[model samples]
Target chain A: MTGHEERFDSVAAYALGALPPAEAAAIKEHLQTCALCREEYAYLRPAVTAVAYSAEACTDAGSGAVAVSPLLKSRIMKRVRSEAASREAARRIWPAYALAAACVAIAIVTGLTDLSLNRQNDAQRQTIADLAAPDARRHFFAGGEVVTHGGRIYIAMRNLPALPAGRVFQAWTLARGATRVAPSSTFAPGSGGVAVVALPEAATNIAAVAVSVEPYGGSSQPTTKPIAVVRI
Target chain B: MERVRLRDADAFEALYDGYHRLVYGVAMRVLADPGAAEDVTQAVFLKVWSSPALFQGGSFGAWIARVARNRAVDLARSRSSHGESQLDETLVVEEDLEDTALANIDGERVRKALARLPVEQREPIELGFFGGATQDQIARQTGLPLGTVKTRIRTGLRRLRNALEDALTV
Candidate 1:
């Protein structure tokens, strides 16, 4: 109902999420090409987000204080520990090809030629063969996907941001009802933000696969939040 | 956040200890159900642990508050179809407010800033933001014209932004 310029008036409302769906969508579309509107949005957006901080915890009439249950923290930490332990196990189980795949990723990421490039190429070809396997099943996550076939897992991610110095991308896997995620491999993306890792482990019991940025040589556990976690 | 991202359970527990109240309070305000609020609190912290990268950078407080509110509002919408849930994608704050007065803002400061708003301006924002009411619903509930509701919300947010910016400066 408003012109492109007049849409400026809705920035605050838009930031507060007060607009109707159609109107909000219109403003969202308009902001894409309008630097002025986008700037205003960027400015006021924080204030809008900050408003939620005004909320107070509900107080009990008798106790005069309301706090979250202690069990909640325990529950959360329990899950976090479980995930960490799983990833640690995955790291411990890092197979030979997993290391080679990690080497390939590092080679691509750092632009360094590896003496074992030929051996890594064989691993890469194995990944391709696994990808083309009739039994290959693909699982998708946020930035990329995993394909599993005949006990081998092939992971391909695109547009991954460059890792910091002394950091590498590591993969982890979780088996069904298992307490830990097994470290599958570690690799870095090429300049184009592309990474391809191949795991030669049997995929029969694996339930999920994830990728994270870890320190060089990889860690016994994930040292960063996973960039992607694909459930098979 | 750095430690937590490193899969440090202790660091994450410290984060939860510091922010659980804020996250739960925001959810409680929206849902008004202790059980539901607890569930949302748990979900929020779990999300922080599971996907710390989702939080790019900013006032961790404000970011988590928004995450709490969005999750609570989503639950509220699913329980009863009063209004569409605000898309999380749209709610992504592009500019980090880390350098502003809002960076260290707390509940009391924000509450006082909100209280300073004129009742007419404050009511519509509260309705839309916390109550998850659309402008049309706000108009119906408050018996005001739709345009008036929109104007008041816009005006209120601008004033709130200015007030927050001024809170720390003065």
Candidate 2:
């Protein structure tokens, strides 16, 4: 109430989450400069929470129409348990995952076989998602969200087939001798194909992308040649 | 899970354990039909079991409500297409507004109470409860004056709170 009308209106709009992106950004910048509007924004939180909670309370508490059978209850509980078990297993397998990751890195670097440093660079630029069998041509990667919105690579591959599980798939970065394999990446295909792995955002200098099939859970690095390679 | 996946026994059982009634209540309140409510309830639980991953964000109640709202909204659209229908004109399932939240506030009861509200107030409430729209989005979609919509929400909340309070006490 410091006689700042525009500031007041902006705060209200922000509380309602109705401001356009540009306006929202402007208001955010303005608030940093104005103490009055900042205080009001803080005061609006409780009201928003109250509005949300009140709406949720409207359903009737006594309706004979909805009834659950005993047989059905047990079924849902079992599914939850199994999913819980799998999450636990994933958590425990990290050490093995780390060791395997190391071996793959050495193969690509030491073997001096493939100088596909450009593959990693291309991954960032083209935002390549998944790799498939060389002969099998598919634009998008297998089991990945192809975001046509931006030029960045944002792959989220989960549970990809393990290298040792047969067939090697190595992720590489393009630069110089200091080539480092992506540590954040994971691969293991379940019934739905490997778990999704999200690669780094796109950058300039990216030249190529490749995925080679190697030993179980894949080798610490590429064993021979790449089954998939694309020049960006 | 394998067994549950086969027959959806676990998800169905969750449906049986009061979650169904609550979801059914939400759908019926919005769509106002016994058969449609039942259909939505079944679909929500079925989806939950079929792809538990879809609603795996920690807040189970919010996830369930979202699924129920989508089904209800779809039903509402079809009913609207028929024209001049009571927005809440689905089959009347019996209901009592008063019942404890965890004790016996069945789904239909909540739905029936929702049906009693005016659309101006009810639409936003439904969307928020169902997670389809934020308060501001609801105002924009309904074309109600923002202050007026907010007021209606406040009043609606008071009424809903009264009903819930009675239920919890009884």
Candidate 3:
């Protein structure tokens, strides 16, 4: 307790998981020798655990709330089974393939091509979220959320009606204190009235976001009033 | 655990059924994305399946929770490529505290305890723990000195330690 005050703060941070990796690693090493810090960490663990556990039930997505798709389990289980089969096959064929492996190695490499191209697309986007405000007016009972990772933005909408065959929904961003709005992206909803639009730039200091119907492809300037708007 | 280590599908399924929701929830809170939460949840389970030795003799729930949280944080860090140094008030989701970790405890008591802490102490803790901001990021976002942020977090945690104990006792 006498000299442990210096590292005590980090123990608390470690419990909350707010420390960066290097600092967290350094603290973990120190905890092995510092009984005082370990005691402090133990005391904080429960309260922190409780806090994290409480977050389990939070759903801020409102009507657009998304859950882990039931189909995902089947997909994972299928992959697991396939991997197991592959391992077994490799084990049985190892000694035989070991002889000609070097000669056919290039062919085996070519065989694996495009095995995961679709999955790679999903994997690259990473972060996905539903964005909505409580007072947002729903058009045709449609709601949506904005998902972002790095500098990319993906907007996913639900219950949105199909536009005129030649029209598309254009997204606009109203930055705080800016008079002119920036056009974000344009796309038509996909099947089941669900649509996802990926934008090239990160949305920053956005005060309001809206969508409007525009002619085929889209217009540099909105051709009509916004169909829906959410004040960020 | 042994069954899972042996690649028993039934054992793995049971573990997933019991813990997937909690794992998904923790991830949702941190990453605020359902797709990402689902991905993290699947990854956490796969991690358990691939490395069952990590859970041979410990609380399974705690292990999964810790793993879920660590994965979620890692994803959040990647989401914020500039690091978590730019939290604004708009970024804070003001969910009812009762709906949080204090759900099982006396909400009013815990609220009162948190309310009693100085703003300086409470703000940092809230931003760091709940908002997922790092200490350096918190200092930059709040315009507070770096040393001050560290001191406040330490002082705040100490106060919370006392407050939580007292609230639970009462």
Candidate 4:
């Protein structure tokens, strides 16, 4: 057989994961540009995948039938239910934001102007003070600014859409020479879709800052893609 | 899947009930430890619950089985230095299988199909796929040449594939 044909012969082994790494990498690269090999790989894939099913018949040498513990199902369901309840609680709180937003809109429509303007003024002042720090370094992101000064970080964001229930925006930092992002803080925007969150971690050693939407209580790792990332 | 995506616990429970055996079975086969198998099974299902969208499209059974096996293999590798092989993620087909007949295939059908494969072909496949052994390792254990082991696996799988297609159509 030709060299290409010889390589193609290994597709089944590749599908079954029997090929070693170097040979598998070669087949993967070849599949990228070679439609014929891709077709063969696709054809063989399901059959190999079906091999996993044969495992269902796995049995113990002494036991009559190998079965999972009855309690295991309850254990799994308990965690599932707890997560669902957390999600449900998050759903319930979300409507409170909507009601608060509606009340603000009604107040504005009814000419309750001073209260709204005062809140805006306070926000503006905070933004000014944050940006005017003598040592502050400002970096702009998609919808926000991250300002670092006096060993602290200030994140000012605007026009962020309200998150679904059980979800919050979480901030992450990557330390210099570190490969993974570290969890920093979590926050939800106000009814006006604006937030100014302060993080106490020193910014000098930080390489980058990112924000992603995660479930309530946040995750150790970013569960969703980052909405914003700014290099320091 | 759509209901589970909406966080419907009942729907997810139904999914778990239907396939938990296959998942636990795969893990048990690889890990041979009830505790480790249970851990892998829990992790696999939780992953489905948290990231239902990870399964873009395809047979849920096949997708989950692969997930169970891979997770068990990872755990096994972590506990030992045996140099187990891993499923190449790139070769995992997210799209529909070429033979849709295999889409909803269950353990019984597959068990029968595999039983029909020659022992030579079946041995290498079982060792490589479920046991996470490399072709070389399988060759060492079975005292067969590497090329012979490779050929048997290829021929065995092709036969199993045809057998599945024929059985499903019937």
Give the best candidate by DockQ: 4
Candidate 3 residues A30-141, lDDT tens each?
7878888777776665566544454554233453433456676787777667655544453343224321231222122123235576643343323221112211111221
> Residue by residue across A1-232, what tens digits does model 2's lDDT show?
4437655655644443334557656767777778777666544422322222332322233543333334333454565566545434433442244223323332332232354766544432332222221111222344332221133432333345445544435544342223533222223433323332334534233344445555544456566675444433
Candidate 2 chain B worst ten-residue window by lDDT = B92-101
Order of quality (lDDT): 4, 1, 3, 2
Docking class of 1: acceptable
lDDT of candidate 1 at residue A198, scale 0 to 100: 63
TM-score of 2: 0.36
DockQ of 4: 0.48
For model 3, the stretches where C-alpha displacement exceeds 4 angstroms are A1-3, A58-66, A81-232, B82-123, B129-132, B145-148, B151-170
Q: What is the C-alpha RMSD of each candidate to the true structure, in Å?
A: 13.1, 13.5, 18.3, 12.1
Q: What local lDDT does model 4 show for residue A54?
A: 72
- TM-score order, best first, reads 4, 1, 3, 2
Q: Whose lDDT is greatest here?
A: 4
Q: What is the TM-score of chain A in candidate 3?
A: 0.40
Each prediction's whole-model lDDT (CA): 0.72, 0.45, 0.60, 0.74
- Candidate 2, residues B1-170, lDDT tens digits: the string is 33333333444464446355456656665665666666666656656654544543333443455456555765666567775332232321111111122233433455566567777666665554443344567678788776666566555644554554444422
DockQ of each: 0.45, 0.08, 0.16, 0.48
Q: In model 1, how large is the Cα lDDT of residue A217?
A: 84
Quality of candidate 3 docking, DockQ? 0.16
Query: Backbone clashes in each candidate structure, one number apiece?
Result: 7, 68, 1, 0
Error of 4 at B113 (Å): 2.4
